[model samples]
Target: MRNAGLGSWPHRRARMAPKREAFSYDGVSTTYEEVAVRTTKLARRLEELGVRPGDRVSYLGANHPSFAETMFATHQLGAIFVPLNFRLSPAEINYQLADCGARVLIHAPSHQVEHERAISLDSYEDWLAGGSEEPLDVPVTIDEPALILYTSGTTGRPKGAVLSHANLLWNTFNLMIGVDVTTDDIALVAAPLFHVAALTQTLLPTFIKGGHSVITPRWDVDECLNLIEGYGVTWMFGVSTMYADLAASPRWPTADLSALRVLLCGGASVPDAVIHTYQERGLVFCQGYGLTETAPGATFLEAADSVRKAGSAGTPVFFTDVRLADTGEIEVQGPNVTPGYWNDPVATAAAFTEDGWFRTGDIGRLDDGHLYVVDRLKDMFISGGENVYPAEVENAITDHPDVAEVAVVGVPDERWGEVGRAFVRPRAGAAVDAAGLREFLLPRLAKYKIPVHVEVVTELPRTGSGKVLKPALRRLPLAPAVSPENAPGR
Candidate 1:
């Protein structure tokens, strides 16, 4: 085998488990042998199109078997795979295409992306049919880059995080140790595959373990619930919102979810109400925390620790090193950590410490041998000379039965330097009010820590990655502060 990267996996798994099911999508199942054959043919076709080693190949679409096949095929030719968020506009999509200098753009018909060399997934089968089925044994090393995942760009422009084969492999190894993925596992990939949480955490690990992956193009609460029972899915990955929607679904109370073994949640902290909903159904969530640069798996809280250490991000993965700086910023160093950003030396240099640890730009604290992520370093606000983390407050507020989602930001205050303002979304039919929310928080939070102002909104602006767009929230018109001393009920 000339390839020492992920390109070798398909063929290796084919030999080990030729008849084992690898992926299931839209009622069609593919075996390891079949996947390997498709991968080889696709690699040959890509090579014929002049995709050389070190060339960038981009994929734009939702969750599909083609996503996995294209990733493996691109790696098979020793090229890098860049998965774009389909939700992005044509302009944003083109910006990423040009940023990566992608040689070929393989996209779905739904996306209106423009590129010089584009291959529509509509003609994907015909494209592969023309290429021979012979194996492509490209000489790829562990240090060679495999993926260029872009950050969410909440504040500034998104930077491409270059992850090597080693980084991804070590991340998978860490996940195997942390979650114990097995061959009998059937993972439901309901989340978008473009995100590292779904790709590196669920899809790749399941593939490495020879487990079957059931991919849904996009998330639909009812469809996911039905697929979990129909396919007997053992495990799956999702964000906080996805889990919340599942719990809110009408079928949730009677859905036959006995086949589900574990549900992995990340992208944000899971609220106490959401966790309790799943717990009441005899299922526990395994929460994780990381960035795209860390191959997305720095820490994972096992199901056993979900209750005792509810809000903690858990300890670092087996192969990662995690520590807090003097300023409470989380620093990570490990094989799974990315080397640097792609083609941006200035950003790359600034991303790491002088001694080489990647500065996570996230504030965290260590307690009881676990890491609790407080908030983004820049997101923390000082209220009345006291520091407050929005995540901590949001977590507490979402615990209210009527509250579905909440985002807190520091609004300018005349009394205090800056006070917290909560933008809350109530449950579907609930009539939750700012006064009721304030009363609910009276016992749960300190007087100074509670939001001085609250606004009930139908929705909060969010980024493509499901993170609340705090900047947008900050731009909204501010209301006069309601001081704790002179508030309506205080």
Candidate 2:
């Protein structure tokens, strides 16, 4: 009972609700008592593998019960857990494994990591069964590092954000207070748990409440819809794109969604159309705004205020404090915020202010007690002496029925210092010409704010967390300035 970190949660939950279902995957369910036993066995195995205090144990796989088990086991031995994005290439994964100096790596089948002991998830059962489940009560502290999550490296190399046990616990408290996850909740975890939002924002809080979680390895529109109806899911978390896909599904009109009580959305702004689509079905989204550094729960837009503050990210969470710099950059200070980046002293120093607040590089606005994230400060550009935020323009463009997705970036212009160029992916069977997009924007945005050029694309590149890779879009070759009538075809 000396463990004060996340590793202690499994046993704690088992003591309180031993028979309650903890998590389910692929039609199999595990109880809290079972999870605690497995966690102890895994911890002992890891300890035998030379994983000591402060050592790192990395996990590379999809959303499975083993992920949570490995994380708990790692922390139980007073070691740091590093969860790698399975979507990344082997080279990328190797960099993170080396960067963190991982002692052991638990990965899915066919995935390889150059570590001393690489344990495949296929053999995870055998691995767990071999270890003796004798009691392991390592003395750990709340401030000790629990996770090292890597940032989506859009600009340069990805840096690991070191989150302490206190940060994770505070974030869980904030989410519980803001969204109300109860013991009766049946949560659907469709997002990848490797991402901070899915892990801390969705799974951890539900686990703490002793709620049941239906975990999926990957997202499939029909599969998710079926799980919701079959399991009578009461709570779920997803990004804007996932929600949009669900709403666009053929069965959306007749799908059984009456059991769903809470839908938490984040990672990007939810288009007004997507919001209306769900509202017409008698469901309201509880949208939040945050980054991995803040344990990913800085603000929450309660379902009650969702309609009133349509585009706002909502107010700061219960324990987090948010402030906007004169330049509109969002700064956060709270127990939930990460202490700093792993092994990068220079980047850590640059990420925080002299006084201690973490500088979230993104720009935002405070209005009527709500926070509206305008755009990334680096993403904004001045066009003809007027500052332009792509998110504002993108939101306006998404209103067009033909558009499925769009990304705007500033390209060098001959007349203006810089001009907005939009890359749009049209909805199925929609032509979505540049002229029509311009005509649609004419009434919605200022002349300066509208994208000067539009190009129809088949798909937009996105990160594993469902965020648009703007840097990739900026790297694309600029198409010629075409007249609306002569716009290129998709």
Candidate 3:
């Protein structure tokens, strides 16, 4: 309660609840007392490496107890913590490090990253074991950049979002009300912890509330389901696709999921059907909407409203402001919003409005104070001068019984300038074809919004957070351009 600095939480909790389990990973569990002690030791070791305040300390690894320890250690010395996405290729990972000017790099045992400043997990512990287990008293304010998370960069080069201690603390306040966190809550962090959604939205809040967190190195449907039953995980966050896969699990029907209170989802809008799948099992799907720049916790749909107001991202949380620009782009202004991108003044200027509103780049509409996301502004295309949002078209296409998952992208057209192409992934045992899907969408969507081409595929390329990789999908070769005029029965 003294301050919401990342380094202070474990120390405070250790005094209040020393024996309480903080985070459980693989087969090992760390108590609040243990976490505070471990982070203190690591902080001293980092100082021995000449890490100073304002320097960047980057961590690249899977979900391990050491990730949290590294975060606390970096912030304790007022150094910036940079968590690299393990899913990124070595080149991409190296690009982020060079861009941030990281001085120290830490990786998991399994990875063999050959950087002059890099240290493996074993070496990290060896250093920690030898260092003094005393807290470092460095000058740190709430406004200091505590963490830097590089964006996925679906469009251009990746930019590092500079999240300050204040930003993260405010995000936890939003999450506490968003998910109703409590001391008894045990969150199963199945998603990649490097992402803001999983770390700030779930794990950080749980830690602050003196609750327990269970980590999975990677998401395996079976392992996640087992943890929910085995550990009695009360809350967890994942994307819509993860939920879809969970519902499709063979043990889903029989799994004892009564212990779960909230099943949080974001990254992309949850399909209406996917929401129903969890609802049928007595689970609440709290779909959220936000960006990494906003410390990633903004709006969250309530459990009760999940069904009645199916596709809405709900209202803004406490201390957050969500408004629309003249162009209908969602603009946010709040303490949770990052001060700016790391070392990029030009990009930072363009990210905000003249009056300081952070441009979210996402297009959405507010209905009765609730937010309904349309699609990304960049993803929207013009067909014969009419605007087409792929999400609107994709929703109609998903109504077909056979279509399981779908990604709609705008392809170049000679007649309309730009037209939509449907990439369909059929349900497990169902069959799908182009003409049939087009006919199914005709009545549900406007004729102009109807896709000119529909190609059935086994799967759509997706990000670690479950967003469809539209940039990658656009690079794929289509079978043949099937115009509306070429409709099978036309």
User: What's the best-to-worst order under lDDT?
Assistant: 2, 1, 3
RMSD of candidates 1 onward, in order: 11.5, 11.1, 11.7
lDDT by candidate, in order shown: 0.85, 0.86, 0.82
Candidate 2, 1-490: lDDT as tens digits: 8999999999999999999999999999999999999999999999999999999999998899999999999999999999997766565578789999999999999786677789998889988999888989999999999999986343436689999999999999999988878988999998889889889988999999999999999889999999999999998998776787798899999999999987888777777888888887778787888888999898999878988898789999999999998889999999999999999898899889989998887899889999998767667664533346677678778889989988989876644446788999999998898777887776555466677788889998999999999899888888787663322110
* TM-score ranking, high to low: 2, 1, 3
Per model, state how many residue pairs clash.
0, 0, 0
TM-score to true structure, per model: 0.79, 0.80, 0.79
**Candidate 3 structure, TM-score to reference:** 0.79
- For residues 1-490, write the lDDT of model 3, one tens digit per residue: 3334787778888999999999999868999999999988888888888899899999999888899999998888889999997655565677788999888899987766667778898777676789798666676889889999987343335788999999999999988876788999999998878888889988999999999999988878899988999999999988765777788899988999989999888777666877888888778888888888999877878877877877889889889999998899999999999999898888889899999999988899998889998867667665543346677677667878898988888877654546788898999999997777777765455466678888888988889999899999989886676556842110
Q: Whole-model lDDT for model 2 versus the true structure? A: 0.86
lDDT of 2 at 446: 48
Q: For residues 216-245, what per-residue lDDT tens digits would candidate 1 score against the true structure?
A: 998798899889999999999987767877
Candidate with more favorable, higher lDDT: 1 or 2 = 2
Error of 3 at 325 (Å): 1.4
